[model samples]
Target: MRYRLSIEDMEPNHWVVWVLDLPACFSSAQTPVDAVALAPGRISAYYSWLSSHDSSLPVITESIEVEIVETFHSFASTQDQEYLVNAFFEDDRRPPNYWDVELALRLLQWTRQDLLKVVQSATQEQLSRPMVCEVRGSIAGIIKHIAGAENWYFDQLDLALDRAQLPDDPLDMLKAVRTNTRAQLVKLMGNERITKNCDELWSARKVIRRTLWHERDHTQHIAHLLAHL
Candidate 1:
Protein backbone atom coordinates (compact mmCIF):
# COMPACT_ATOMS: atom_id res chain seq x y z
CA MET A 1 0.00 0.00 0.00
CA ARG A 2 1.29 3.43 -0.94
CA TYR A 3 -0.14 6.36 1.02
CA ARG A 4 0.42 9.95 -0.06
CA LEU A 5 1.62 12.28 2.70
CA SER A 6 0.79 15.92 3.43
CA ILE A 7 3.29 17.45 5.79
CA GLU A 8 2.29 20.36 8.02
CA ASP A 9 5.13 22.32 9.58
CA MET A 10 3.49 23.77 12.67
CA GLU A 11 6.45 25.57 14.23
CA PRO A 12 9.99 24.15 14.41
CA ASN A 13 9.75 20.89 16.27
CA HIS A 14 6.13 20.03 15.64
CA TRP A 15 5.68 18.42 12.23
CA VAL A 16 2.60 16.43 11.28
CA VAL A 17 2.47 14.05 8.33
CA TRP A 18 -1.09 13.41 7.32
CA VAL A 19 -1.82 10.23 5.40
CA LEU A 20 -4.23 11.56 2.80
CA ASP A 21 -5.54 8.14 1.88
CA LEU A 22 -6.60 7.45 5.44
CA PRO A 23 -8.44 10.50 6.74
CA ALA A 24 -7.99 10.15 10.48
CA CYS A 25 -4.49 8.63 10.54
CA PHE A 26 -1.33 10.78 10.93
CA SER A 27 2.21 10.83 12.30
CA SER A 28 4.01 13.59 14.22
CA ALA A 29 7.71 14.16 14.86
CA GLN A 30 10.14 16.89 15.73
CA THR A 31 11.26 17.54 12.13
CA PRO A 32 9.93 17.11 8.61
CA VAL A 33 12.48 14.41 7.82
CA ASP A 34 11.59 12.31 10.85
CA ALA A 35 7.87 12.97 10.37
CA VAL A 36 7.91 11.73 6.77
CA ALA A 37 10.13 8.84 7.81
CA LEU A 38 7.48 7.85 10.34
CA ALA A 39 4.52 7.87 7.89
CA PRO A 40 4.87 4.37 6.44
CA GLY A 41 5.00 2.84 9.89
CA ARG A 42 1.96 4.84 10.95
CA ILE A 43 0.10 3.78 7.81
CA SER A 44 0.77 0.14 8.62
CA ALA A 45 -0.36 0.66 12.19
CA TYR A 46 -3.51 2.42 10.95
CA TYR A 47 -4.41 -0.54 8.78
CA SER A 48 -3.78 -2.89 11.66
CA TRP A 49 -5.97 -0.71 13.86
CA LEU A 50 -8.87 -0.69 11.39
CA SER A 51 -8.66 -4.41 10.76
CA SER A 52 -8.55 -5.12 14.47
CA HIS A 53 -11.69 -3.07 15.04
CA ASP A 54 -13.69 -4.27 12.04
CA SER A 55 -13.07 -7.74 10.65
CA SER A 56 -14.61 -6.63 7.35
CA LEU A 57 -11.50 -4.67 6.46
CA PRO A 58 -9.01 -6.29 4.14
CA VAL A 59 -6.17 -8.39 5.47
CA ILE A 60 -3.09 -6.41 6.39
CA THR A 61 -0.25 -6.32 3.88
CA GLU A 62 3.44 -6.45 4.74
CA SER A 63 4.55 -3.76 2.33
CA ILE A 64 3.72 -0.11 2.96
CA GLU A 65 5.00 2.90 0.99
CA VAL A 66 4.50 6.64 1.53
CA GLU A 67 5.49 9.72 -0.46
CA ILE A 68 5.34 13.33 0.71
CA VAL A 69 3.16 15.00 -1.89
CA GLU A 70 2.34 18.30 -0.18
CA THR A 71 3.68 20.49 2.63
CA PHE A 72 2.34 23.58 4.40
CA HIS A 73 3.88 25.86 7.00
CA SER A 74 1.81 27.15 9.89
CA PHE A 75 2.45 28.69 13.31
CA ALA A 76 -0.89 27.70 14.81
CA SER A 77 -1.66 24.22 16.07
CA THR A 78 -3.63 21.90 13.76
CA GLN A 79 -5.97 21.11 16.64
CA ASP A 80 -6.85 24.79 17.03
CA GLN A 81 -7.42 25.36 13.31
CA GLU A 82 -10.17 23.51 11.51
CA TYR A 83 -8.24 23.36 8.26
CA LEU A 84 -4.88 21.89 7.29
CA VAL A 85 -3.14 22.31 3.91
CA ASN A 86 -4.00 18.77 2.96
CA ALA A 87 -7.03 18.74 5.23
CA PHE A 88 -9.39 18.51 2.32
CA PHE A 89 -8.23 15.54 0.33
CA GLU A 90 -9.85 15.14 -3.10
CA ASP A 91 -11.48 12.11 -1.55
CA ASP A 92 -13.26 14.18 1.07
CA ARG A 93 -15.46 16.02 -1.40
CA ARG A 94 -17.30 12.86 -2.31
CA PRO A 95 -20.60 12.37 -0.51
CA PRO A 96 -20.26 9.78 2.21
CA ASN A 97 -22.46 6.69 2.22
CA TYR A 98 -23.87 4.65 5.06
CA TRP A 99 -20.74 2.54 5.30
CA ASP A 100 -18.45 5.54 5.53
CA VAL A 101 -20.11 6.95 8.63
CA GLU A 102 -20.55 3.46 10.08
CA LEU A 103 -16.85 2.71 9.83
CA ALA A 104 -15.98 6.13 11.22
CA LEU A 105 -18.35 5.65 14.16
CA ARG A 106 -16.75 2.31 14.89
CA LEU A 107 -13.30 3.86 14.77
CA LEU A 108 -14.58 6.58 17.09
CA GLN A 109 -15.74 3.98 19.54
CA TRP A 110 -12.37 2.22 19.46
CA THR A 111 -10.34 5.44 19.81
CA ARG A 112 -12.42 6.61 22.77
CA GLN A 113 -12.02 3.21 24.34
CA ASP A 114 -8.27 3.43 23.78
CA LEU A 115 -8.31 6.86 25.47
CA LEU A 116 -10.39 5.83 28.47
CA LYS A 117 -8.30 2.71 29.03
CA VAL A 118 -5.11 4.78 29.19
CA VAL A 119 -6.57 7.26 31.66
CA GLN A 120 -8.56 4.80 33.76
CA SER A 121 -5.50 3.38 35.45
CA ALA A 122 -3.97 6.73 36.37
CA THR A 123 -3.86 7.70 40.03
CA GLN A 124 -5.26 11.09 41.09
CA GLU A 125 -1.70 12.35 41.66
CA GLN A 126 -0.67 11.43 38.15
CA LEU A 127 -3.77 13.08 36.63
CA SER A 128 -3.24 16.47 38.29
CA ARG A 129 0.58 16.67 38.13
CA PRO A 130 1.54 19.62 35.95
CA MET A 131 3.92 19.14 33.06
CA VAL A 132 5.98 21.81 31.31
CA CYS A 133 6.05 19.88 28.03
CA GLU A 134 2.27 19.69 27.58
CA VAL A 135 0.34 22.75 26.46
CA ARG A 136 -2.67 21.58 28.47
CA GLY A 137 -0.34 21.18 31.50
CA SER A 138 -1.71 17.91 32.92
CA ILE A 139 -3.62 14.75 32.11
CA ALA A 140 -6.78 16.22 33.62
CA GLY A 141 -6.48 19.33 31.48
CA ILE A 142 -6.00 17.25 28.36
CA ILE A 143 -9.17 15.33 29.12
CA LYS A 144 -11.22 18.54 29.23
CA HIS A 145 -9.56 19.77 26.06
CA ILE A 146 -10.59 16.60 24.26
CA ALA A 147 -14.25 17.03 25.15
CA GLY A 148 -14.16 20.73 24.36
CA ALA A 149 -12.63 20.15 20.93
CA GLU A 150 -15.30 17.60 20.14
CA ASN A 151 -17.98 20.19 20.76
CA TRP A 152 -16.15 22.86 18.82
CA TYR A 153 -15.99 20.60 15.77
CA PHE A 154 -19.78 20.26 15.71
CA ASP A 155 -20.22 23.99 16.16
CA GLN A 156 -18.19 24.57 13.00
CA LEU A 157 -21.33 23.49 11.12
CA ASP A 158 -23.57 25.39 13.52
CA LEU A 159 -24.59 22.13 15.15
CA ALA A 160 -23.84 23.09 18.70
CA LEU A 161 -23.61 20.95 21.83
CA ASP A 162 -24.96 22.60 24.95
CA ARG A 163 -22.03 23.60 27.17
CA ALA A 164 -24.25 24.28 30.18
CA GLN A 165 -25.23 20.60 30.35
CA LEU A 166 -21.70 19.20 30.38
CA PRO A 167 -20.57 17.51 33.58
CA ASP A 168 -17.90 19.02 35.82
CA ASP A 169 -15.81 15.87 35.91
CA PRO A 170 -13.49 15.64 32.92
CA LEU A 171 -14.17 11.99 32.16
CA ASP A 172 -17.91 12.41 32.46
CA MET A 173 -17.76 15.49 30.27
CA LEU A 174 -15.85 13.48 27.68
CA LYS A 175 -18.59 10.87 27.70
CA ALA A 176 -21.36 13.46 27.42
CA VAL A 177 -19.74 15.39 24.61
CA ARG A 178 -19.05 12.19 22.70
CA THR A 179 -22.67 11.19 22.96
CA ASN A 180 -23.52 14.54 21.40
CA THR A 181 -20.81 13.99 18.76
CA ARG A 182 -22.24 10.60 17.84
CA ALA A 183 -25.72 12.03 17.44
CA GLN A 184 -24.59 14.90 15.24
CA LEU A 185 -22.35 12.69 13.15
CA VAL A 186 -25.09 10.15 12.59
CA LYS A 187 -27.19 12.94 11.10
CA LEU A 188 -24.37 13.55 8.62
CA MET A 189 -24.21 9.94 7.44
CA GLY A 190 -25.85 10.46 4.07
CA ASN A 191 -25.96 14.24 4.03
CA GLU A 192 -23.27 16.05 2.07
CA ARG A 193 -23.96 19.57 3.26
CA ILE A 194 -20.91 21.82 3.64
CA THR A 195 -20.81 25.07 5.56
CA LYS A 196 -18.17 27.64 6.35
CA ASN A 197 -17.62 29.15 9.75
CA CYS A 198 -15.30 32.15 9.70
CA ASP A 199 -12.54 31.40 7.19
CA GLU A 200 -12.73 27.62 7.75
CA LEU A 201 -14.89 25.11 5.92
CA TRP A 202 -16.86 22.22 7.38
CA SER A 203 -18.13 18.97 5.92
CA ALA A 204 -19.06 15.59 7.27
CA ARG A 205 -15.75 14.20 6.04
CA LYS A 206 -13.66 17.01 7.53
CA VAL A 207 -15.49 16.80 10.82
CA ILE A 208 -14.84 13.07 11.06
CA ARG A 209 -11.20 13.54 10.13
CA ARG A 210 -10.50 16.20 12.75
CA THR A 211 -12.54 14.55 15.48
CA LEU A 212 -10.70 11.27 15.11
CA TRP A 213 -7.30 12.95 14.95
CA HIS A 214 -7.91 15.07 18.07
CA GLU A 215 -9.09 12.23 20.26
CA ARG A 216 -6.47 9.78 19.04
CA ASP A 217 -3.74 12.41 19.33
CA HIS A 218 -4.64 13.19 22.93
CA THR A 219 -4.93 9.51 23.72
CA GLN A 220 -1.27 9.21 22.81
CA HIS A 221 -0.52 12.39 24.72
CA ILE A 222 -2.08 10.96 27.87
CA ALA A 223 -0.22 7.73 27.32
CA HIS A 224 3.03 9.72 27.13
CA LEU A 225 2.12 11.54 30.34
CA LEU A 226 1.40 8.27 32.09
CA ALA A 227 4.71 6.84 30.88
CA HIS A 228 6.78 9.62 32.46
CA LEU A 229 4.71 10.14 35.61
Candidate 2:
Protein backbone atom coordinates (compact mmCIF):
# COMPACT_ATOMS: atom_id res chain seq x y z
CA MET A 1 0.00 0.00 0.00
CA ARG A 2 1.23 3.50 -0.72
CA TYR A 3 0.40 6.16 1.85
CA ARG A 4 0.93 9.85 1.31
CA LEU A 5 0.68 12.51 3.96
CA SER A 6 -0.35 16.06 3.17
CA ILE A 7 -0.47 18.64 5.94
CA GLU A 8 -1.24 22.33 5.83
CA ASP A 9 -1.04 25.16 8.33
CA MET A 10 -1.41 28.92 8.29
CA GLU A 11 -0.05 29.69 11.73
CA PRO A 12 3.40 29.46 13.23
CA ASN A 13 5.42 29.17 10.03
CA HIS A 14 3.44 28.59 6.89
CA TRP A 15 6.53 26.86 5.55
CA VAL A 16 6.01 23.17 6.23
CA VAL A 17 8.76 20.74 7.17
CA TRP A 18 7.87 17.17 6.20
CA VAL A 19 9.80 14.02 7.04
CA LEU A 20 9.39 10.28 6.98
CA ASP A 21 9.08 8.30 10.22
CA LEU A 22 12.36 6.77 9.24
CA PRO A 23 15.30 8.48 10.98
CA ALA A 24 15.04 11.67 8.92
CA CYS A 25 13.26 12.06 5.60
CA PHE A 26 11.84 15.54 5.43
CA SER A 27 12.10 19.01 3.94
CA SER A 28 11.02 22.48 5.06
CA ALA A 29 10.51 25.78 3.31
CA GLN A 30 9.47 29.27 4.34
CA THR A 31 7.87 29.80 0.97
CA PRO A 32 4.33 29.04 -0.18
CA VAL A 33 1.15 28.35 1.74
CA ASP A 34 -1.58 25.70 1.58
CA ALA A 35 -1.83 21.90 1.34
CA VAL A 36 1.89 21.43 0.67
CA ALA A 37 3.02 22.52 4.12
CA LEU A 38 3.24 19.20 5.92
CA ALA A 39 6.44 17.47 7.19
CA PRO A 40 7.54 13.98 6.19
CA GLY A 41 6.36 10.92 8.07
CA ARG A 42 8.36 8.04 9.56
CA ILE A 43 9.50 5.05 7.49
CA SER A 44 7.97 2.52 9.83
CA ALA A 45 4.60 4.01 9.04
CA TYR A 46 5.23 3.43 5.39
CA TYR A 47 6.37 -0.15 5.91
CA SER A 48 3.32 -1.00 7.95
CA TRP A 49 1.05 0.71 5.47
CA LEU A 50 2.70 -1.07 2.58
CA SER A 51 2.43 -4.43 4.34
CA SER A 52 -1.30 -4.25 3.67
CA HIS A 53 -0.38 -5.17 0.07
CA ASP A 54 -3.17 -2.97 -1.19
CA SER A 55 -1.04 -0.01 -2.37
CA SER A 56 2.51 0.77 -3.34
CA LEU A 57 4.48 3.40 -1.47
CA PRO A 58 6.86 5.66 -3.29
CA VAL A 59 10.59 5.42 -2.76
CA ILE A 60 11.63 8.57 -0.98
CA THR A 61 14.82 9.77 -2.63
CA GLU A 62 17.02 12.80 -2.10
CA SER A 63 14.51 15.24 -3.58
CA ILE A 64 10.99 15.90 -2.37
CA GLU A 65 8.73 17.65 -4.83
CA VAL A 66 7.52 20.99 -3.42
CA GLU A 67 5.33 23.43 -5.28
CA ILE A 68 5.16 27.14 -4.49
CA VAL A 69 1.79 28.39 -5.64
CA GLU A 70 1.32 32.08 -5.32
CA THR A 71 -1.95 32.14 -3.48
CA PHE A 72 -2.02 35.88 -2.93
CA HIS A 73 -1.37 38.81 -5.17
CA SER A 74 2.28 39.74 -5.60
CA PHE A 75 1.52 43.32 -4.55
CA ALA A 76 -0.82 42.37 -1.75
CA SER A 77 -0.79 44.29 1.50
CA THR A 78 2.42 44.01 3.49
CA GLN A 79 0.48 42.62 6.42
CA ASP A 80 -0.68 39.75 4.23
CA GLN A 81 2.51 38.39 2.75
CA GLU A 82 2.00 34.73 3.60
CA TYR A 83 1.68 32.07 0.84
CA LEU A 84 1.70 28.27 0.53
CA VAL A 85 2.34 25.39 -1.88
CA ASN A 86 1.33 21.74 -2.24
CA ALA A 87 3.56 18.80 -1.27
CA PHE A 88 3.47 15.45 -3.03
CA PHE A 89 5.10 12.34 -1.57
CA GLU A 90 5.41 8.81 -2.94
CA ASP A 91 6.07 5.44 -1.28
CA ASP A 92 9.83 5.97 -1.11
CA ARG A 93 12.26 6.92 1.64
CA ARG A 94 15.60 8.70 1.55
CA PRO A 95 18.68 8.21 3.67
CA PRO A 96 19.28 10.61 6.48
CA ASN A 97 20.94 13.80 5.21
CA TYR A 98 20.03 12.99 1.65
CA TRP A 99 18.14 16.26 1.50
CA ASP A 100 21.30 18.32 2.05
CA VAL A 101 22.34 18.37 -1.57
CA GLU A 102 18.82 18.65 -2.86
CA LEU A 103 18.02 21.57 -0.61
CA ALA A 104 21.20 23.41 -1.53
CA LEU A 105 20.68 22.92 -5.23
CA ARG A 106 17.02 23.98 -5.09
CA LEU A 107 17.84 27.10 -3.13
CA LEU A 108 20.63 28.01 -5.52
CA GLN A 109 18.27 27.72 -8.45
CA TRP A 110 15.54 29.77 -6.74
CA THR A 111 17.96 32.51 -5.80
CA ARG A 112 19.39 32.68 -9.28
CA GLN A 113 15.92 32.96 -10.76
CA ASP A 114 14.94 35.61 -8.23
CA LEU A 115 17.98 37.75 -8.91
CA LEU A 116 17.44 37.54 -12.61
CA LYS A 117 13.78 38.46 -12.31
CA VAL A 118 14.47 41.51 -10.19
CA VAL A 119 17.10 42.87 -12.52
CA GLN A 120 14.97 42.24 -15.55
CA SER A 121 12.00 44.05 -14.02
CA ALA A 122 13.80 47.32 -13.53
CA THR A 123 14.15 49.93 -16.26
CA GLN A 124 17.35 51.68 -17.25
CA GLU A 125 16.15 54.81 -15.46
CA GLN A 126 15.47 52.83 -12.32
CA LEU A 127 18.88 51.22 -12.34
CA SER A 128 20.60 54.56 -12.94
CA ARG A 129 18.77 56.18 -10.04
CA PRO A 130 21.25 58.09 -7.87
CA MET A 131 22.78 56.08 -5.01
CA VAL A 132 21.00 58.05 -2.26
CA CYS A 133 20.58 55.54 0.59
CA GLU A 134 16.92 55.84 -0.37
CA VAL A 135 14.87 52.79 -1.28
CA ARG A 136 15.63 53.08 -4.97
CA GLY A 137 19.33 53.48 -4.45
CA SER A 138 19.38 51.02 -1.57
CA ILE A 139 17.77 48.24 -3.59
CA ALA A 140 20.09 48.88 -6.49
CA GLY A 141 23.04 48.92 -4.16
CA ILE A 142 21.93 45.66 -2.55
CA ILE A 143 21.90 43.98 -5.94
CA LYS A 144 25.31 45.36 -6.71
CA HIS A 145 26.59 44.28 -3.32
CA ILE A 146 25.40 40.71 -3.83
CA ALA A 147 27.18 40.58 -7.15
CA GLY A 148 30.32 42.00 -5.57
CA ALA A 149 30.20 39.45 -2.77
CA GLU A 150 29.88 36.62 -5.27
CA ASN A 151 32.89 37.99 -7.08
CA TRP A 152 34.86 37.87 -3.83
CA TYR A 153 33.98 34.20 -3.40
CA PHE A 154 34.92 33.41 -6.97
CA ASP A 155 38.26 35.14 -6.56
CA GLN A 156 38.92 33.20 -3.34
CA LEU A 157 38.13 29.99 -5.18
CA ASP A 158 40.47 31.09 -8.02
CA LEU A 159 37.56 30.82 -10.40
CA ALA A 160 37.97 32.53 -13.74
CA LEU A 161 36.07 35.75 -14.24
CA ASP A 162 34.23 36.52 -17.48
CA ARG A 163 33.89 40.15 -16.47
CA ALA A 164 36.15 42.34 -14.30
CA GLN A 165 33.47 44.84 -13.33
CA LEU A 166 29.79 45.61 -13.80
CA PRO A 167 29.05 47.61 -16.91
CA ASP A 168 28.83 51.38 -16.46
CA ASP A 169 25.48 51.34 -18.25
CA PRO A 170 22.63 50.81 -15.84
CA LEU A 171 20.85 48.16 -17.83
CA ASP A 172 24.10 46.51 -18.75
CA MET A 173 25.15 46.47 -15.10
CA LEU A 174 21.98 44.64 -14.17
CA LYS A 175 22.54 42.10 -16.91
CA ALA A 176 26.16 41.65 -15.94
CA VAL A 177 25.30 41.12 -12.30
CA ARG A 178 22.73 38.46 -13.16
CA THR A 179 25.11 36.66 -15.48
CA ASN A 180 28.03 36.83 -13.06
CA THR A 181 26.04 35.73 -10.02
CA ARG A 182 24.64 32.74 -11.91
CA ALA A 183 28.15 31.71 -12.90
CA GLN A 184 29.33 31.87 -9.30
CA LEU A 185 26.42 29.75 -8.12
CA VAL A 186 27.12 27.21 -10.84
CA LYS A 187 30.71 26.91 -9.64
CA LEU A 188 29.69 26.65 -6.00
CA MET A 189 27.33 23.79 -6.85
CA GLY A 190 30.25 21.71 -8.11
CA ASN A 191 32.17 22.07 -4.83
CA GLU A 192 31.94 19.43 -2.13
CA ARG A 193 29.02 19.52 0.24
CA ILE A 194 29.48 21.84 3.18
CA THR A 195 28.80 19.89 6.34
CA LYS A 196 25.75 21.16 8.19
CA ASN A 197 27.57 20.60 11.45
CA CYS A 198 30.62 22.50 10.19
CA ASP A 199 31.17 26.23 10.41
CA GLU A 200 32.04 26.45 6.74
CA LEU A 201 28.42 25.90 5.76
CA TRP A 202 27.64 29.27 7.30
CA SER A 203 29.71 31.17 4.75
CA ALA A 204 27.78 29.83 1.79
CA ARG A 205 24.43 29.56 3.54
CA LYS A 206 24.76 33.07 4.87
CA VAL A 207 25.23 34.45 1.39
CA ILE A 208 22.09 32.71 0.21
CA ARG A 209 20.13 33.64 3.30
CA ARG A 210 21.28 37.22 2.98
CA THR A 211 20.09 37.22 -0.57
CA LEU A 212 16.61 36.36 0.69
CA TRP A 213 16.67 38.89 3.48
CA HIS A 214 17.95 41.57 1.16
CA GLU A 215 15.08 40.93 -1.22
CA ARG A 216 12.41 40.99 1.46
CA ASP A 217 13.80 44.14 3.02
CA HIS A 218 13.80 45.96 -0.27
CA THR A 219 10.50 44.54 -1.35
CA GLN A 220 8.75 46.45 1.39
CA HIS A 221 10.75 49.55 0.61
CA ILE A 222 9.76 49.37 -3.01
CA ALA A 223 6.15 49.06 -2.03
CA HIS A 224 6.43 52.17 0.09
CA LEU A 225 8.04 54.03 -2.78
CA LEU A 226 5.28 52.93 -5.06
CA ALA A 227 2.72 54.25 -2.64
CA HIS A 228 4.23 57.72 -2.82
CA LEU A 229 4.68 57.63 -6.55
- Top TM-score model: 1
The TM-score obtained by model 1 is: 0.84
> Each candidate: what lDDT?
0.80, 0.41
Query: Which portions of model 2 miss their true places by more than 4 Å?
Result: 1-105, 108-127, 131-142, 153-163, 186-202, 211-220
Q: How many backbone clashes does candidate 1 have?
A: 0
Candidate 1 runs further than 4 Å off:
10-12, 51-59, 75-89
Residue 3 miss distance in model 1 (angstroms):
2.1
Tens-digit lDDT string for candidate 2 (1-229): 2333333232345443332222122233455333244432333433343333324544444433343322321222233344221222231112213353345345445445545566566665564566555643644665565555555444434542555555655335545655655555544533443321111222333333333334333444544543443
